[model samples]
Target: MKFPSLFSPLKVGPYQLQHRVVMAPLTRMRAEKPSLAPRPLNVEYYAQRATPGGLIIAEASPVVNTGFGSPGIPGIYSEQQIAGWRKVVDAVHAKGGIIFLQLWHVGRVSHSSFQPGGALPVAPSAVAISSEFKAMTAEGKVVEYETPRALETSEIPGVIDAYREGAKNALKAGFDGVEIHGANGYLIEQFLQSRSNLRTDQYGGSIENRVRFLMDVTKAVIEVWGANRVGVRLSPYGIANGSGEADPMPLYSHAIKSLDPLGLAYLHFIEPRSSGAGRAEVNHQNVPSAMVLYRPMWSGVLITAGGFTGETADAAIAAGHADAIAFGRIFISNPDLPRRLRRAYPITPYNRATFYGGEQKGYTDYPAHDEMAQA
Candidate 1:
């Protein structure tokens, strides 16, 4: 009965959730290398986090070989990778948890080393990410990002095909649904924001043209899995990976209004305050809240993720600002997040050093609340 609204039953799309503490899709970079497939360790990590009726959006997975930016992150383009994800899905389901795979492409955030034949990464335009941001090559060396090749109009369909195929593969992998990773500074955001997308094709020019790629990609994925089983994440005023708009209202309002009629599973937002958490620990004071600003435009379930604790998350749900709250960093340290929150147990602080690219040290080794008490 504690945090009543946060622990209340809710329905998203075709499935029902016992609690509203959704697991935000996090990039841990711990998949099997070379193959870039989810291994047994990854399976164990997900299974440990699975709670009976909880929703876990798995990490961002590239849709194609060229889509890779970091080493060890999983991909959905290969038979081997599909088999790897099948294991993950089966493990989560065995625990009675619902899992969704997030389809992603890093676009210009990639490097030549991560590309095939050392070709430059591709994006909507050839613009390079500013020097303020850094990219990791396949060899794990930190280097400045190079200007990417502007995707030819003819080649655009191939990219969309990758997403559609990824959706089909996710279905084959036994996932309950799929989420389009349109947030952060990835491919979709590269196309949505004018700073990254400078193309004059159908995917650029005016706001309508700029949003064309996102719409086209969403429709393609919907064709594979119905709109009801698909969700889209957007960061209207985010500054992740050097992505920002001169003005975000007109652009995001148009995007939100456009997706409203699709009847999709949900519209997820990354609150502007915590948008840069992927790169560093940041809390921007006086930033506008995404859910509060855009909730009116979305008629379906609205899930927003940011620096939300148990009390704040409950407050958000009680205020009708968001239907559910997704937790990221805290979820990493506490596998039994829902139970801990429900009982108001002490939360273990996360070790940022071991957040990405590590073994059981900071992952599956984290003891559940009961185990800690027994110890």
Candidate 2:
């Protein structure tokens, strides 16, 4: 039951991570101000779990003003925001932990309130997605999803530049690396799936055309933080935020093949099928070869996430299935998750309440093993 395999040093692009336990990026809207930036509380929350040899991908932060779809979510487009994130990055590094900022753009999965001056949401096509997002409305909160303004062919480069600017800001903020949030039915993902993208331009239509947006974003980010410091999160079969791919295998194969040349730090993909109890099952035909297919395509590290536990993660690494594994909810409830996994300690269930907005009740108050034992 030893995790020596998991504890082994591994190289990701240009940086070396101490262990394979990565804290997956999870949304926790706790920024002090809606349009401002991360505050001391956010810094404290991350710093508390900054364990040696572990990697923490911070919560998804918007890359541009129009890309923001949630209130109180951090952004990397402003100078003040960079300074705010610097504190968090420095705090984590001071504790001997590696941190990455997940740059994001929500596309049409946003409300008018989340956009600038209450403008309409923007996307690849003018078509309105059946998927709706929660936002603050004048008459209290609502789930009204508005039709988005389709981006003209000329305006696409500006969107790519937003990711580059966010990457630059991440470096200024002292992050070890940057992870482009291309998964979970976000902007980059929306462009990849035919269901969301109805454009007939170079950015949409054929598989190569549909994958153009993701490629542009990745290349732009590489310019800011060298390809070695960049990573991408993709969900081939992810069903969140109103997404369904008619044909994902060939679509992703083309996309990953194009991205392989970038030599990114790592390409993290959500296992197409996963059990709720942290077990991965290859149940989808669209994602051919899984990690095997991706390894040959991308010359950098390959990490797998979604519903993985300590035992499962170790097995995957030992079997050469993945270089590393990321944990989401487990890390939320157990900051010392790596240590607990080492000893096979019983994990305390996470409280459903206080997951999003609330005091630090269930956020950072979870005690470590020794504290629990003493209590």
Best by TM-score: 1
**TM-score of model 2 relative to the true fold?**
0.91
Segments of candidate 2 deviating more than 4 angstroms: 1-4, 131-140, 274-296
- Candidate 1 lDDT, tens digit per residue, 12-104? 999999999999999999999789999999999999999999999999999988998888899999899999999999999999999999999
Residue by residue across 63-90, what tens digits does model 2's lDDT show?
8888877667788888888988999999
Worst 10 residues of 2 by lDDT: 274-283
Q: Candidate 2: lDDT of 170?
A: 90
Which pairs in model 1 have colliding backbones? none
Predicted model with the maximum lDDT: 1
Local distance difference test values of all predictions, in order: 0.93, 0.79
